[model samples]
Target: MNSLIEDVSPIAVDVYRSRRERVLAQLRAQGGGLAVLSTAPEVMRNRDTDYPFRHDSYFYYLTGFSEPEATLVLNASARDGEPASILFCREKNVERETWEGFRYGPEAAAEAFGFDAAFAIGALDDHMPRLLADQPALFYALGTSAELDAKVRGWIDAVRAQSRSGVRAPTRAQHLLPIIDEMRMVKDAHEIAIMRRAASISAEAHRGAMHACRPGMREYELEAELLYTFRRHGAQAPAYGSIVATGANACVLHYPAGNATMRDGDLVLIDAACELDGYASDITRTFPASGRFTPAQRELYDIVLAAQSAAIDATRAGVSFDALHQAALEVLSQGLLDTGILDKAKFGGVENVIAERAYARFYMHRTGHWLGMDVHDAGEYREADGPRDEQGARPWRTLVAGNVLTIEPGLYVRAAEDVPERYWNTGIRIEDDALVTPGGCELLTREVPVAADEIEALMRESISH
Candidate 1:
């Protein structure tokens, strides 16, 4: 019979192998330990309808297995000499596949995903204790997947009960996050490749939106064009919700309504997103609904563009993640002062008195976030002391080669009686996915038009053609 699961891409397969080796090395460094990991379970949004199933980000990072209810166990012991990773996945069920979809059972999972050992899901309870029998430390996220957490607790408890027969269970059960997150921070070649592709698709999607958007069109209609570009170009789906904001609707951050009418002279802030092969790309761009910016709109747009450029420049090896945010804030804060939105005399010391607070009213969100399997990707950035310490911090320690992230800086001004009349109903955001490298940072979405002139030319080209 023909297999429904398309052959896993080489890039995805390589990612799985690299992550496994990393976990093994970490376990070996720990002087021998075992870690149990599981993908998130399918969640129900309503009867017979399931919220899109996304594998646990961590699990997906390590195994590249998108299937739900799967478990991965790393068995490492000083006594055994080396560590091995075993994957447990759904067994062949023809009837179930006929109903829901096809699944790669253990044998197929082993061959396709490059696991050292493979077992059926039904064997987890029977096999887990045996794997953990004498491990001295357990590595796993304790409270994440409740059902899997309970199952893991039961398995550990059983192993603990056998403490009498010289079979000592893990004396310490540390959270798996830090160990795994360290590996995820510096993406390997394969991950970078996938992210580059994701960014390309995302950039194309944003360009599509910019070209299709018109003054009288509904925001959702613009969103539809973006999605069409995503699927047509082989993106799995949006990395996050598509934010299509027009007019005053742009003032509402996290606005997903996307149903408002885009009026002439308004800037359409499309935070269009896309993902490919599980690697994520988040991009945002503001376009003039009339195909050309007004004097006031151009002023704010150039400020944001400059801020975004400064922020991207700040992404480099050894530069603190906070540095980029601060750089962006400096640009935005001063822009506000220059535009008369902020009174320099009254707020003269605001930027100095408060770090990042002076611009918080207008720029509410963080300058950027880690981009990976999830959009607001996981991995802790700050240390326990709230400082950047690579040794102690997993993800946000420092920008390193191979790490992919977004630098998005935005300004939103809602309509108000006292507010500057010209600034009302204006929202501007510019975002780009960057890859930190040894020499400098590479802008992944550079192919997409960003400069005001470039964007206008692209829009004009589309209209003329």
Candidate 2:
């Protein structure tokens, strides 16, 4: 392995090679074909500046190639009786290298990334036609990119042009997302190790935010604490934009403008996590800015904490994905009725409230989402069960070992005429990443305090020290 590549990525070379071999085996089972994958294109942030470049998930899954302007080609059925993994990448240019940084040209990329054959990206148009000829099928992310779609069409046309000269273009075209998505859904040992590290780093960052938060401070100030912790621990970036919502702002699910000043009596809700080695960890913690929750705030916070506990308990193998959501909903519905938030006479009862989904007014979003390479990671939530219903309800998939997901249960009480005045403007959510196991599940983000008293105590200790 090259020292440069080793220093950049913690993933071993054999791990990447093994991933390619597994994908090739799956392709062979599908009767063999040629699959093409490309990295994300660089985008302009402004007139002359460019946004940070991140490679496409699928391309990186197999090749681990991070450079822009690169494409991976996998030929499962090769004419030479050996499978071929080819890479097309930027060639070395002294002038470009002077301005930019070093590029692993064709030779270095092939050796470093475990590709059998390598070519300059400039030759893709000339080489793709020959590569496409005589293949039984063509596999690519159909409809993903207009440029790539046109390039594939042009390559097919080039192959068809040679039809009379004893060449044949692929008659079958298939979408490669489902095949790769399934492979990525189950985390291998290596992926789990990296994810554990990511979770640990993010957990400490959340703790830091809780400790650093103070009344009269801006939300972005707390956000800065989180960013510092992530980068200080070697995380690449936040999995998503950090949400630092205080008081009423927490009522908004995806609030990005975290500029409001926190009040002494307000509760701050932070939904933030970081990405390490391309694996993501998502965690959310809601705590009082004054280091102690008031009576009404503690009431709502305890309810949300209980609901999250129920959902986490249900995250186990053989359970359907919706089961966890249903468990959390039941707990939240009962809690709302127990409190004055939901009127028993108007909503009829806890059972009727759940049936009518009346709880959505206060807890609108789903309990949680799949977390992985992307925050809402790939794997489909629905599985084929007979004919689909008219309401378009797909059957939920059963959880399996190695599946990592978040259990987040929240309650947002905005100012409403019918809502209890005491509970208004109080939003609380407790989220933690859980890995399903045969026995039950393991909470990856458990190091951060979730209990109300524990959170208060931790904050107080930080201040006194």
Candidate 3:
């Protein structure tokens, strides 16, 4: 952890507090219950070392506190004496504090995080039975955590043991994430601000990667540049494994940056981004390692760029999520036909190729996905409980204001007798973060050049400098 973490609270305390209140209100409406959630446990990476601890998204949504072995208990059925929100966390130990940074203890955590009450984590088992007794319902994800499930059962059993004394466990249990996911999908102003900054930071990293790229550089060297740029720009880390694929390696979608040397005639596909605070921004750009795209490569690049443009154009309030993907797919299908990547005589037309998925040889994967705290952020993609269409699928959810997603359309041509030899081993992907608005959508990762000519210009500038 760095000092940057202390500054992670760009969203005011009231935002998390308000979310907790909303969860409590939902619980109260559903016959009142206690909702219990625990932060992620710190896992041991090896014999003595430990993996970097990350707080659980669900727990952090309600409480901004970022400590492991912490649990939040919200009692919707609290009486006049009981507080609505309670947090139980690791007890303070001076010896442990000397080794492991700070622990809020209980009183400090309650005050710092706006909880009504708090206690040591050690007391949770002792207190859960009393908290669960006679509640109408319990709210938590049922099967996500085996450890949490075992603890929940023990609490329920403890309440059951008191049945002779006229106490009863909760009668019903509800999954909590669906409600939370719904809340998380729509980016509020605070979240959007963080995401915007993240996008800016990541855009700079991409630019840096392009600048450092050159002929005869190993793929890993370009990757190192990306990582250095991310951290240098105050980002905690890369959003995901930085994909710095060079030459034919670009054909592998999730190719890890390795020892493959970037050659003069090859293209590098960089699918990377950065994380700021907790939100993630994703961007992918493909460009020539020699600072110039060949005719064949430039043609593929233009097609993917045009497809991304179509998808971005279709992204707005009231459009289905799938509609944006369809928009990109149509453009890409047409591009494949024009380029001879998909035989026009065999595929007939763009619609026929799409219906048959004949263009899948060079283009696969969806156009984009929901993006936020997690790269593939939470939220149902399709309409819940809607009647199945003739495709036997539920309708995709319509886009609304505050929804953020990615518009990434790509083409990967592999060596095949059926494929044009000139287009072989070329991969191009143009990705940008799209924030849906009333008019259309805002492109977040536009700081980096996506246009083929612009990329060549940026690379030339990089080489001269």
Candidate 4:
């Protein structure tokens, strides 16, 4: 067992310690191995400067350590009785601290971050061989880090050198991500609390952006409003690039805020959110940049909103993962037919449009994705057992109580002779975070208005003053 300081983070130390214990149990179950994971390497933005540092999600999940150039080793070897959870990190340097920031060093890190033992990172090569000796397997993620792979090889090679002395290198290897990914998929009470705060902050930013938007403003000006709101409320940073698309710009799904000017009679689509602590919250809302949706714009906006509602209703524990997407798709496919986007005479009906995936012309992306640590998060979507469906592919897993996801359904209409001119260049998307529960799903980002009427009212009120 590792030593713990009660105040490691907003999350209790016991949670991380328990997670490490679970990994140990998994390792022991696999006949004793050394579980090794390293934090992300810091990348240089330019000469003598670096990009913002973020820890590797897997490493942070178990260690709760956020520093760069750090590694964790969990030894569960029966023969080599050794440290269960060990940390290797940077040693304290006052000169470096003055230029950079505080360094926990080894002794302080061991006590403060609750590791069984800690040492300067430079000593990993020297100590790894000893840890590798007599172990049955070495557990590390495959295709993750070349440096780690090289180090593991060197450690085993060092141990093999002493084989004549009865020292045995590991004969087996295993991937640690599968186990850790499953753990991250389910939200614990601590993670849920942090996510709720992130959602609230992001919701406020979306609401503010809608209020600040006007017909004459540049897209970047609206984006600045979002940044201001996120930081003003104490968010660390944007979870992803903020998309402040106006008019035809929204037709590009991944478009970031540009110099494009918002004009009257155009819809403004914003897909933005904040990362509070290490957790992330995501939300997207499309509204009229002029504080009023044109007749055609409101018609299409209502369709997208209704599709999102169907998807939200389909999200709950025991529902298959694809059920929600299919629910939204069915609604969207019908809407496309109703709007004649997919010519009703040529495409036949909703059944044929879905069968042909014809709705992709306007609504291309999936309804949503699992939302957590990374914006896309970490988790296997399909049943790991094997393919059981008639399509000969593995089926998506059923929704569980602890799961959280987004319900985003959108429409991007490009100009064409056959397409209606009024609907051309109109891109509308509505997104919200949903927490799956036994009874139903909770819409975490609803604090920002979703209904077309509510959005119009909020915008008109803000602009009136």
Candidate 5:
């Protein structure tokens, strides 16, 4: 490992501490138990080729350990004051290394990831029963891996066997989600730094796509440009599938069939976002295939931009998490009414339409979501009763300082005989990564040109020179 990469940032340490507190708190509440977590397994690309390995989201969130076929066990009753964080990993083999690549093995894994103890994966069955003996309950995401599930059940059954000796096994098994996800909801400085960098890089990619868009270019060609830009700027990978929809195709959300050739008089909507070291940045920008937007396109684009502005304003501290979507929906609904695209009566009243979900036909998806390690960063905004858990009286949790989310406001009009001619076949979305701060919201994507006139000006500047 490079010395530079090995020196984990203070933020990373902070994130680790936060995660530990969450897991330990749960373990203590349960009165001493063993919590087991596993990394994602590598899947095959073809007959023998294996796809590039990526750690499981929850596992990475807690341990920040990126290796494959590794399991983390937290022993709550360890003699040490602190709960034991143990990892079982592959042992280094010279022969295997010669054929494949470097393996972290047990020693390196423990030291690098700050685990209390480490052992070879081969010793799991032997170690598990002894460690889990008489524990109160088991903590793990069961059924995530069939093999792991079977192994865990077998180990628990062995513990159950002790009933004849008056040794009772744990009758409870708690899913690790509630505790882990709650920990992930709030971003520490370290996670925020990575996410900010990712947003900057993703913004650059969107800018590149904006400048590269021109008549006769295939949508996939433009997508290639955006992806190359992301990699060049050092994002780990695209947070989600890149959508390079041109003209009417933009109406199709999640459109990844990027084969359409851009035309002179069409709008190109590029919904491409990326993840940096796992922290995600999602952004959507719609621009004209030609350098400048047509009059109707500009009108609709401005409405979406205005809606996004409202959404950003709604992201202040102590504001409802859904306030932004409501604000943006108001702008969108008004714009549709002004453009005569929707019947105010048919859509169940403009303002009421949003509450009743009448605008879903065109909007299709939520205005935005929490952006972090996972694109739809793990954590629930609502409780089982579908109400805010805490944080204030807006019927939704208030936006806090460390919350980073996307403020994406879009309006898609599909081509149909009944649709107004002026608004036909136009899909417009303007998205920016907004960071909720103590004072207010800061637009992390301020660099990527977004003002209607600014986008056109940048396009002109790029092409004319």
Candidate 6:
């Protein structure tokens, strides 16, 4: 059988090789250190059953090795003729393979993954001391895992014990995340391609849910539609828990228990997306369960839609992430004032409402967040004094080409004396995956209808057929 036929899609072997080379170059720049990374350990979902295992983001970013109990080591400055990239993974066991699944073992793992060498995980303890010796620095996910931390300390102690000889252990230890996280923030061509497909698949799932929705159906039924669409289109799983919220449940941000019965005249907010390969696509669409929105529901939905539109327009290169949030907030605040949700007499004006954050009563969350491999993904919002502001704090990082983020602007109106009674229990959020481009940004999750008319039309068409 051809090896290429069995390898994972979206990430080619050359992509993994280039990622390791990039990290190695950075490590060499930091004085030729030896860097170590480990995959996430398997965890139990219940008494005996194990939850599905996912590889660590940082580790997979470089090695593209998905197996658990694996570690990668990069010797940036290797001795002449020695390979710089090494992998330590589980040794193949015939019985275990029969019980659990296939094992690549070391030899095939190294060749398939483009590693310089590979060893059984059992040899990690024996190899660590030698790998740490005579290096200028040792780099790993410092303070992340106590077990890994203790293992590093043991290796260092072993190297120190050989002080009588000329051998030397690394004196400095650095955190490997900061260096690698910056690399993960920017999506490459391959990553963007995978994300685009993920986004398209997720968008179709949302459309499916919209078409399948009915007033008498349970929220979980809509969630089932999403899951079915996701799996049918080759998605691994939901990027996060599917949020199938109707009526008051939509007001709760992170509403995971989707068991409520959807009612007529209730607006359902479906905040769900799928994970394709290792990338994530996040999308949220709120529409009427009864195929037509009430007058109050349309009023609030249009406001939230306008805010999202403003935010999406502001999502361009060179603008700070905070700027997009502010743009969305401004639109939302003005909409509140226009719709009589906020009294200008008591809340002052639109500017005063935003300045005082009076809009928090209706619009609470930030406009968006970085979206990629891990959903929330890796990347810094701020850096050390890179750019200063009037308040003497570092400003949010500016958007750059290749940065993919979510533009989510939401509004939730709970019953209050100041709030209109008709708008009570109305919650709506419009979110889409956006990629920064040279001109502006591309909307990755735009296939689904967001406009009230379009959503109702789509639902009507589905019902008619």
Q: Using Cα atoms with residue i matched to residue i, what is each candidate's TM-score against the true structure?
A: 0.92, 0.97, 0.97, 0.96, 0.93, 0.97
Q: How close is candidate 3 to the true structure, as a TM-score?
A: 0.97
**Candidate 4 local lDDT, residue 372:** 88
TM-score, candidate 1, is: 0.92
* CA lDDT scores, all candidates in order: 0.82, 0.89, 0.90, 0.89, 0.81, 0.90
* Candidate 3, residue 351: how far the Cα is off, in Å: 1.0
Judge candidate 1 against the unseen true structure and give its global Cα lDDT, from 0 to 1.
0.82
Best candidate (score: lDDT): 6
- Give the C-alpha miss distance for residue 200 in model 1, angstroms: 1.0
Specify the poorest-scoring 10-residue window by lDDT in model 5.
385-394
Higher-scoring candidate on TM-score, 3 or 4: 3
Q: Candidate 6: misplaced stretches above 4 Å?
A: 1-5, 8-11, 387-392
- Per-residue lDDT of 420 in model 1: 79
What is the C-alpha lDDT profile of model 5 across 100-182, one tens digit per residue? 77777888767776778889988988888878887888888866678878988898888778778877676788887678877
* Cα lDDT tens digits for candidate 2, 1-465: 546755544356678888888888888999999999998999999999999888888888888788999998899887675538999999988899899888898988877777898999999899889889999999999999899899999999999999999999999999988888988888888888888999999999999998898999999999999989999999999999999999999999898746899999999999999999788999999999999999999998999999998998888999989999999999999989988799988887778989898999999988878878889999898885755667878778889999988999999999999888999898888999988898788999999999999999999998897
User: In model 2, which runs have C-alpha deviations exceeding 4 angstroms?
Assistant: 6-11, 81-83, 387-390
* Candidate 5 C-alpha error for residue 290, in Å: 0.3
lDDT by residue (177-253, candidate 6, tens digit) is 98888998889998999999999999999999999999999989999999999999999899999999999999999
RMSD after CA superposition, every candidate:
3.1, 1.6, 1.9, 2.4, 3.1, 1.5
How many clashes in candidate 1? Answer: 0
